[model samples]
Target: MVAPARLDLDQRGDTWSSLPDHDVDVLVVGGGVTGAGVALDAVTRGLSVLLVEQRDYASGTSSRSSKLFHGGLRYLEQLNFSLVREALRERELMLTRICPHLVRPVSFLYPLKHRFWERPYVTAGLTLYDSMGGARSVPRHKQLSRTKALRMVPGLRKDALAGALLYYDAKSDDARHTMTVARTAASYGARLLTSAKVERLLREGERVVGAEVTDVESGETATVRCRVVINCTGVWTDDVQELAGGRGQFHVRASKGVHIVVPRDRINSETGLILRTEKSVLFVIPWGMHWIVGTTDTDWDLDKAHPAASRADIDYILEHVNTVLAHPLTHDDIEGVYAGLRPLLKGESESTSQLSREHAVARPQPGLISIAGGKYTTYRVMAADAVDAARPDLASNVPESVTEHIPLVGAEGYHALSNQVETIALRQDLPAWRVEHLLGRYGSLVEELFAMWAEDPSLKDPVPGAEEYLRVELLYAATHEGALHLDDLLARRTRISIETKDRGVTCARPVAELVADALQWDSGRVDDEVKAWEARVAAERESQTEAADQEANAERLAAPDFRNRSVGRALA
Candidate 1:
């Protein structure tokens, strides 16, 4: 028995063509981790759920994050004990039970500047961090002398540190993890659609009964009735609140963080590095073949979709990270650059980094609920809290959240399959590395995708110009992940655009063709998709080179808006 490939924008016309003319129990707007989590939680509790997004899943801030399921060591320093404990617990769940295949433990080295005073001060903190709930997942922190630390990382400058402390945190592929969770929601009978925009809230006597949705691809509109509407639009939460008629109980602020990626060989080290910046923390993390360094937090008043990285932002990270490096990296060394906005809870402080990371839920109206402002690590908790709050308006005695014990679709039986990758690769006539990649991303679901390749052996070859990716992955994205445009496959489904040095320039056309078939596009439509994707990349590159954050942000907003301009254009 096989489940039908997941529904997406390419199939929106056919899928929604026969959608019931009546309302659903809940309509969730946004497809990030939080939104997907909400859909999954709501469905398990017996609520009829429908989740829609303006673009592909995880295409916004979700995919652009630092890629760590962290407990936020900085939060511990701020005396935020509750946040750390809760986040640590979540981190353990992701690594040990929830999605072990996607989340894994990563070690980070923090070098001490002042000799005697700093080591003990930092050692005590690291000890407490290592002793947190389910801390057995990774090794405890270790203190090393200056010489030993230098020996461990020969790339470090001689005068950079007096000593070092090593500790652990968990990392994940944010985009893939999000897509899998959404698929899990679908398996549980929730209706999930991407590239479907919510044009307006359908209100009946001051209470929202449902939402009017527009299919961005075919230009068709449908009214999806629901007993309640959950606004999980992250940075756009306040804008969604206003759509419900300026009646929200709370507000949210946007803070932009920019990061740069370089090849791993440029910074030779055995472990990842964490450094203290004047304003915030800087992480030199290990991606598959690259090192991710960054994160400058500043108040953003520009575009939320494309938060630009100004020249100052780049220099701030470079300057701080360079202080400890034997060799400094220039613009030429950067392979890719990206910026994302954090939906932080608003505060009196001007510094974005100083703003609260805590989340809040409010039922500003009789049938509308809005959730905003929390770090990615706490997504599940935030989703549970949201459904609990919206339950009252659901007008039913809903059961307790069941998602905690639910393993996402690909999570169950993952550990044993990982051990069988080499054998599977041999039988499939593929490289072990490729098999590992598939298992890491899809877990036991790889068998389903591999069957497609077995039917047509040509699909076994790597994607043109994107050799690390197989054609089957692109096919899987459209068939199962709900990708619509070339951007959806390259930018979110596979991350080839950001992972490649040419930024997926050569691979765009082939991916566009694949999507064209799935969406039933003509020559003109295909050409428009290619043009739009190029323009999107051009705008992002231009924004990164700007001298100031606001200028860069404004320039980044020049591309086409994802929201339907005919009705809900200004996303605020």
Candidate 2:
């Protein structure tokens, strides 16, 4: 097997210089999971592919998700059996064959309030859920009495439940998983570009042929010729469609989802919890040393780029989850907070919560195709469908997508390395727990980090303020992963931004200085990056205090984007 491609500064320069020289069979316009999956599918099917993202890969809604790979249990209530079945199939594939290193099974306790009717009703639904996707990697749903449930969860209030149902689902680091998908696509010979925006579509008398691309950092422009352009821009779908000189077939509405992170000990549950709300469902997921509880689904019309979580949003989540908790949580308990937007296909329903999660692909013109509106679990299917839509436009006979059998970059030898964690720890002179942490994040790719550690011992030191991550991880983010800015490294690459109380502010300078050499950032550049990140954190903090969405959004937009700086010197 070929080694995964390095998306370092050198590769970025080369790819940029060669952009206008050749025309690819497919030009995927987005860096989120759907776009990344499309790139992987297209390249593996014997097509020349190039994927470009306006910002960093998974920098938008892709990174900030509920981080689950389950068939939507709530969708079962909506009677969307087909969607649930499809998602469950993908969930099984992710756990066993695809990216097992990143995705894992997580059990959730569904507390039953009504004694008689609720148990039987929920039982029937869960039974159908278990049977939908065959041959599951996780155990089936199990019924638990109130006593047993309280024994398992001790944090729940005594009167909160008469009984409970424990069901299994899969969870993952969404940002990391999305980035891995892009890297896997790169490994398959797809040219991936980030911080590159598509200004407009290049057309030949109504038949769209290519796009006018701009390097967001340097302000340089290039025309990328392609056989077909697949639009996977998510919430920015309409903007891309407008660039194509048409409204396209549909519209995409943005829905805001807010989540708060707190220390794991604050929620004394052995497993995660799922609660039903009036609008939708709430998930209190286990995220390493933290518990991620959230998600208030409300219509967001303000800013698509940086969706801010209002004070009201946080209160709503706390209000709902507090109903069942033995000790109610307050604002002081929250360590980190983040908000993400969902790109829903605009339907007749005014409520974003009621909108469809099912995706749609449209070929508005001869050479252009747009795909929108699916959940993260079905991204592979969405990508395959998008590629299938582009087949008619391709001059040559296109092969069918084979991404189903393909394992992501780090999945190849993950289980074997997992078994050798203690041996690896002894060999590297590190603690067993540290080795386990590294293995969980990088899987078989932990060897790459070990190789770096062998060269520079200091790289193995834990990052200050966010000791969970090592300095080597930040270095790797710059050298191997395509991290162009400080936000890219902290927010998406390592998730230190949302895992720590200070929101990565304390470790900002250290991380920037560590990656300086790899990114060719001088002292001035480093200072600028740190200041920008600090301002962003401050802005987000201020925004979270506001009661209304507009007020919060205005505050979040106060920070300056550091990546908007001109590229005066070429990266080494």
Question: Which candidate has the top score in lDDT?
Answer: 2
Model 1 is weakest, by summed lDDT over 10 consecutive residues, at 563-572
Q: Which lDDT value does model 1 have at 161?
A: 93
lDDT of 1 at 119: 88
| Residues 1-572 of candidate 2: C-alpha lDDT, one tens digit per residue | 65988999999999999998989999999999999999999999999999999999998999999999989999999999999999999999999999999999999999999989999999999999998977379999999999999999999999999999999999999999999999999998999999899999999988889999999878899999999999999999999999989769999999999999999999899999999998889999999999999898999999888999999999999999999999998999999899999999999998999898999999998899999999999999999999999988895678888999999988999999889888988999989999888877788888899899899999999999899999999999999999989999999999899899899999999999999999999998898888888889999999999999999999999887655753223221
TM-score for each model: 0.95, 0.98
Measured by TM-score, how close is model 1 to the native structure?
0.95
**Tens-digit lDDT string for candidate 1 (1-572):** 12424665534555577445646787889999999999989998988888998887887789989999988888889989788888888898888878888898999989999977988888888887877755678888898888988888888998999889988998988988888888888888888888788888878888988888887865788888888899999998988878777567777888888899998889878889999988889999998888999888888887777678888888888888899999988888887888888888888988888888988989888789899888899899999999998987885788999887888767777888898888888899888899888888887788878888889787788888888899889988887778777777888888787778878888888877765766676876666666666767788788878899778877777766533333223222
lDDT of 1: 0.83
Candidate 2 residue-pair clash tally: 0
Residue 91 shift from truth in candidate 1, angstroms? 0.8
List the global CA lDDT of all models: 0.83, 0.92
Off by over 4 Å in 1: 1-5, 8-11, 18-20, 561-572
